[model samples]
Target: MARSPKDVSAHFSDVAEVYHDLRTTDQEPIISIKNQLGHLLYKPSINAADIGCGNGRYSLLLPQHLGDRLRLTFADKNRCMLNMLTKRLDHTCSSEVIQSSAECIPVCEKSFDFATAFNAVHHFKLKDFLAEMARILKDGGLLFIYTRTQEQNRCNIWGKYFPDFCKKETRLWKERDFCRVVAQTSQFALQDSVYFTYRRVSSLERLIEQAEGHHYSTFWLYSDKSFREALDRFQQNITAQFTDPAKIQWTDENTLFVLKKIREAR
Candidate 1:
């Protein structure tokens, strides 16, 4: 069955409270992407918009590496996530939290030096969101969209364990083709980018716990019984895949695309 955007949005918002706590440890793929995004921002003063900035993860992390030279707006459709981010990073940096969908950002045109979204591009209206991001970014501004390449990495194995979740996840994600589409979009010109691959070592059980509340947990939109059954099946699969579940680990490859918006549109 096709997934509903509204339903997907609500599920994540509802679980935002326990989400970060359960998945505080990011896999290597996530870390690499975050670091690459930070590396791409080595410059002086600038303004950045963090679209789909769930709990302000990148918002808080970016400033640390980008130095204190940026004014950041952490935006998301989920108020719960934004509220948590505001409370967490209230006293640091120049930040304003706004609740808005990626398809339609409330900020002004050519207002930001950069815009970024991590692991959230699949949830956005690609064309509309990218165009809006391009419109808001100043000339030569940067746009970074990052996502996991294959879902089976041990970091994401929990989702594939359950048939219901596995099926949903497979459908919800875009493969390599979407990357080309994004690169060719009229909103921005693809710029210099790097693809970082890394492996994260984690136990099977921990992966399962993280899967329950992490970004991919949108599969929970299924009925409680369905979700539970899928989780059960997933657990079984994990046990089968690993001899000593505690010692077994998996690796994931995630990609980050750094794009530069052309100041003059044709």
Candidate 2:
């Protein structure tokens, strides 16, 4: 069975450093997410919150996109992750860090102009988290959610090589389901939904190292025996299919949902 969100958060605290190292790589998909956010509206003295802001990767870019005009609050359930983020920012004046869960954000109601969650929603209690987001967002405020839907995950290169990848990621919401949840709230209107594709090419050796490191949360759920067996199969498959271990390629597919708060809560 999969662990509860609280348990998962605790586990992440233990592996925060490894998680940061694996995810902070100069990947094209990550770059694209940042670029897309840059295209959105940014104004002077705007307040923003990044929920579940692991290691502050996406939040760190907001300053560059919105300049000193942006005041940011980074929130996460994991204290260790928050501590790492604070150290990374070196306690910048423009930002504050809070240890809070997504279901109950520790901020005043209608306090933020913008909010974001990158690949973190699957771990949340969806209904409660969305309600909290609705409560915290100012009228006309925007919310950006970037994640890989179950459909997209099934199409990933890892799914092809590791047979259990898709099965283990059953918690991920489909694109249609995500859209419906936002629309059903009647508090947000869908502004835009975009699908992005990026190609990642890396040495097979490096890929195996990432797998062994349990870079993804899904990998953490696998038992030791299952993880080792999967890795062995993945390596064998790569060796048999590719002529060179240095030229392995994979497709990364993601969806970015842009939503606008349309009206004040009744």
TM-score of each: 0.83, 0.90
**Which one is best on lDDT?**
2
Writing each residue's lDDT as its tens digit, candidate 2 over 55-111 gives 887778767656677788899989878878877895443888889999998789999
Writing each residue's lDDT as its tens digit, candidate 1 over 89-187 gives 955578888899898888889988777887788777777887898789887777877766444333455444556554556433444566677667876
| Model 1 segments more than 4 A misplaced | 1-6, 24-44, 150-155, 170-175, 212-215
Q: What is the C-alpha lDDT of each candidate?
A: 0.68, 0.78
**Global local distance difference test of model 1:** 0.68
How many clashes does the backbone of model 1 have?
1
C-alpha lDDT of residue 117 in model 2: 89
Worst 10 residues of 2 by lDDT: 24-33
